[model samples]
Target: MPSSLPSTLLFLSAGIFLAITGTLDAITFLAVIGCAVCSLLTITERTELAYIGGLALISISLILQAVLESKCITCLKADTLILAAVICLTPFQNFKLPAQIMSAVMSVVMFFAVVTVVPVESESTDIKPHGFGQYLEVQETSGEKLTLNTAENPVLLFSPSCSACEKALNKVMEQDADGTKWKLVLSSSKEKDIKKANELLKRIGYTGTLYTYDWHGSVPIVIYTDENDSTIVSHSVDKTIPLL
Candidate 1:
């Protein structure tokens, strides 16, 4: 019975580490719990430690989930509950198979309880919008140097053919038809695509300025800058088009 101290400490430390660092693998710990359940360890006083381990594992799973922010985190929570039940009820050394089964059930419950409390882009404006403004590379119909040396609230909107980019562009164009404050830059790598991008200007009726550069795989990049603070918001997925 006293020997269960080390195991409890180990499990507790693991749970706490998981909660803080959000890096421990809950599945591995669950597997450990499973092995203990199927073994003669469940019939010993040390079985209680396994239940504690289950609780700790769940705590770790939830803490890491909040920090890491992944869609797969729910799976971790579910699996931990199942293993915790085994630990809670299997500590009865004399109750035979029924006790072990009960342990399994309680282990699952402990798993659920630990997590029940912790309910806590992509074209991402995630990217700092920079270097997309190549206004010097632009040329008008009269071969005049199209420069944005004096435009107010100059917003450089870059996009390819991504649906998110398309949606963002449509929103920008719909709101700002004259394209005075918004600069839509079609990003493309292929030569044929550049020619197609030229039509985008005509489609938008943006007589103000048009700029193009070799697309380096970053679609829907928006850069908003002023004399005071420069803000770059770029993303490959759905994001707010801030070129207005």
Candidate 2:
């Protein structure tokens, strides 16, 4: 059996364990200890490359532990047990030095590596508020005579044909904005399509302004108006929200 293969396997196992557990834990600590044992064994056998390789494995393990944020107690227990086992085996060879000293050095290096490179904190911001400047102006269609009040709050449009648009509209419905004023303008290029849309809205019991024959239905564009329904905030196609 090749002696180096065991160390290689140990290193691979340590990497897999760290990836699953994420920053710190008992497993990572043990892996560091195992590397030191392998290193000492290689050193006594005059296998300098193997010794270096073992130390490298230990270093890598420590780095992973540090990155993952494993607890010191767990790491210490693992290191001590593995080093103790290696020291016991060192007596069989004509070694100049005990494994204890080498193990101690490797452990210290691992601790420093973790402390230096801490995990960065990440924050998530809602995409809805990024470009949400003002409320869109949703007046009644040319045929419809209802002049609905514009809700000072944000409103997203939803079309019937698009399933994705329906899902987004559902989310808006669930959102807590009972006091917020909103109007849905059902626009269709064809008169029949507009009639179908009105029928669907009526069937679903949606009490909002219905607009038909909207020639300017560019889609996903949020409209912003001033106090006097004069100017627009901006005309943009927001793909994140179905504002068509």
Instruction: Identify the leading candidate in terms of lDDT.
Output: 1
Give me the overall lDDT of model 2: 0.41
Return the lDDT, model 1, position 17.
Answer: 36
TM-score to native of every candidate shown: 0.37, 0.29
Compose the digit string of candidate 2's lDDT tens values, residues 1-244.
4444444444444444433332233544555455545545554553444444455554554565445332232233333333333333333334426445665676676455434322212342122233333433334445545333333433444344333333434444444223144445443435555665566566555555555324222222234344565323222323223322
Q: Which stretches of candidate 1 lie over 4 Å from their true place?
A: 1-124, 129-146, 149-151, 188-191, 200-208, 236-243
State the local distance difference test value for candidate 1. 0.46
The alpha-carbon lDDT assigned to residue 80 of candidate 1 equals 49
Query: What residue runs in model 2 are displaced by over 4 Å at the alpha carbon?
Result: 1-155, 176-180, 202-205, 213-218, 225-244
- What does candidate 1's lDDT look like per residue over 1-244, in tens digits? 5544444444444344334333224554564444344333334555655554554545554554344322222335443433444444445445557666755565565555444422222222445334444232443433444554312454444533233444556666666766766665555334455554556555656555555544443345555444554444444222233334
- Each candidate's clash count: 16, 8
